[model samples]
Target: MLQGKPLLGVTLVITATLLFAINDATNKYLLVSYDVPLVAAIRNIVHAILMIAILGPYQGHRLVQSTRPGLVIIRSVCLTVGTLFAGLALQLMPIAETTAIIYLSPIIVVLLARPILGESIGIVGWLAALGGFAGVVLIARPGGGLDPLGVIFALCNVGATVSYYLLTRILAKSERTLTLLFYSALIGAILFGLAMPWFWFGAMPSNFEIILFLSLGVTAGLGHFCFTAANRYAPASVLAPMTYSHLLWAGILGWLVFGQLPDSWGLAGMLVIAAAGVAVALRTRFARR
Candidate 1:
């Protein structure tokens, strides 16, 4: 029932990618001075509050209602763990490289879909998946200068993300988009918020730090909103390739905010991953037709 507006959808998705890149940069900056739990707690708390204030009146009981409550909770847990891993990775690695590694999730999904979802990926899909893994090896190659622990965290995030995406694929058939989004924010807020006292030992955030902390939720919430809204205007095929724009934005922000740029090898790895992901997306689209 959604209207087709490909151009608008592309714009919104690109905007979402930029906002998310900014959020990641902000997270990396804050993680330098704060623990992962505290940072994640504040981000989700603000995000939950914003969602309630904006969607509560309009959505009412529907915001919390889910026919697949258990699966929804599982999905939310995946997101929560992914957030923690991502924060830990950002704390130790450059944003551009971390983001590139995290993107391995899509490729991982392709590899798993045949066994898990019973969808055949064909020869091209297998090759693309292999190429994607090779790209990660390049990024994490010996003498690449990346923190090994950070690479591990990024890979952990990829696992969480692959599970999240698979669950989303199953649940999308039965759930409303807002319900899923709200639960993700709600669960993250509750889990991290409960763990805050132990991780709350840092110096009180400065006025500017508080602002940055608050902006985390704003940017994240807006990015999700834009991403969801974009789906209403464009098909998944159009949106899929556009998601790769995140790497470009991440690289730019990483340089501008953190003065960090990926080395040539890292850049090449990112391009390979992007190319493979695009190939997978386009192949899926054509296969569907």
Candidate 2:
């Protein structure tokens, strides 16, 4: 059985969160001029190619092997759908706000862990989840001036994310991390590649933009690899709150890249979310003692 390494898992998750923030910022930048599906396709295509070129030579069939094929497929589907929604939302909303709303998935994951993963979340965990939700409400509250459609897309992403994380936790026991990452990359590449013709109408990207396109896969592939690997070391509940780090990364990227920053209320919301994550981490640490 995979051994528990909570500290390592938390560190891996935090690393993944930073990588995912960079990926999301890059996607938001490209979505301005490229179709969502087209951008998503390139991201996945490069991801699959990188995986095959890097891991295939060493692992070959082992990279695709899985004990529970059905669950892996379902998880891949959730990730693919979530990517679409996240892309659409990014096109219409600021990265930080879109990410803040989507971070609600971690809270939902905490709530679902007991029933879905047979993992218990004590009272502190439950309260942390509620605090996280309240933070999202602050970020998505009325008069926030966010696009309603973008908010909707982000919320949809939350559903997909919750399912994706839960499934990741479940599959971590029997599936190798590379196998899970490969399946997700393969499914996205195939689905979006098949649909590319309909969405491929943009001008040829400049050399710099081309590099940006390729970087999507690099960042995302690494992010997912870390994310999937972390689950093998920690339960879903412990790792869920660590994902809040994405909010901080997203906010910084949005301001630095796009010159967009959340207002006071939104900043308050982010602080609440961060505080809740800290609380959860401390609670988990103390409980272990």
Give candidates' CA RMSD values in order. 0.8, 2.8
Local accuracy of candidate 1 as per-residue lDDT tens digits, 1-289? 3848999999999999999999999999999999999999999999999999999999999999999999999999999999999999999999999999999999889989999999999988998898889889999999999999999999999999999999999999999999999999999999999999999994799999999999999999999999999999988887898999999999999999889999999999999999999999888888989
Model 1 lDDT, residue 153, Cα: 97
Name the lDDT of candidate 2: 0.88
Compared with the true structure, model 2 gives a TM-score of 0.89
The runs of at least 3 residues in candidate 2 whose Cα sits more than 4 Å from the true structure, single-residue gaps closed, are 1-14, 226-242, 281-289
What TM-scores do the predictions have? 0.99, 0.89
- Overall local distance difference test of candidate 1: 0.95
Q: What does candidate 2's lDDT look like per residue over 66-145, in tens digits?
A: 88999999999999999999999999999998887887776677688888778778998899898988898888899998
* Clashing pairs in model 1, backbone N/Cα/C closer than 3 A: none
- Candidate topping TM-score: 1
Question: Where does candidate 1 stray beyond 4 Å?
Answer: none
Lowest lDDT 10-residue stretch of candidate 2 = 280-289
Q: List the residue pairs that clash in candidate 2.
A: none
